[model samples]
Target: MTAPGSIEPTDLSPLAWRLLRIAAGYEQRAVERELDDILQAHISMLESGSRALSNRRRQTLLELYAAELSPEQVTAIVEHF
Candidate 1:
């Protein structure tokens, strides 16, 4: 129900934030231990624009975090970074 030109929940890359929040609340070590899967440092790298991700990775993150971003927002972020 965003008005025209209004900001949406997927306006920014909130997946990283959501992931960190989940990790902080649950098990940080388990998330960090996934081989070939970046964790806390991945968030830093993303925020710093040091690493770009594949489309599948983006969707995987969204699914893993169980975030509620809209499809529009998801596509926007996936295309953007």
Candidate 2:
């Protein structure tokens, strides 16, 4: 078992991405605007597991959500996902 507040290494699933965005205080529309290339519909598809997250998008999300998540957690996500 891991210590308190530590994240377990695991795949960065669509649901996990959604949760991270929500936890970071961003609405889907806001994230869509930030991503520029991605539309709200595409964001919805990504969160719903109907679309795959490209590496570029994943890196963007990591940057976007960095403030809300710890560096260690982000590293774990990047390494294991």
Q: How large is the C-alpha RMSD of every model relative to the true structure?
A: 7.7, 5.5
TM-score of 1: 0.38
Which candidate's lDDT is highest?
A: 2
Model 2, 1-81: lDDT tens digits are 233134332346776677677767788898888877777787788779897767677666656876777666555544444
Off-target runs (Cα >4 Å) in candidate 1 are: 1-30, 34-36, 67-81
Poorly placed runs, candidate 2 (over 4 Å): 1-10, 72-81
TM-scores, in order shown?
0.38, 0.66
- Tens-place lDDT per residue, model 1, 33-60, is 6424757666455545576555455444
Best by TM-score: 2
Q: Which ten residues in a row are the worst by lDDT in model 2?
A: 1-10
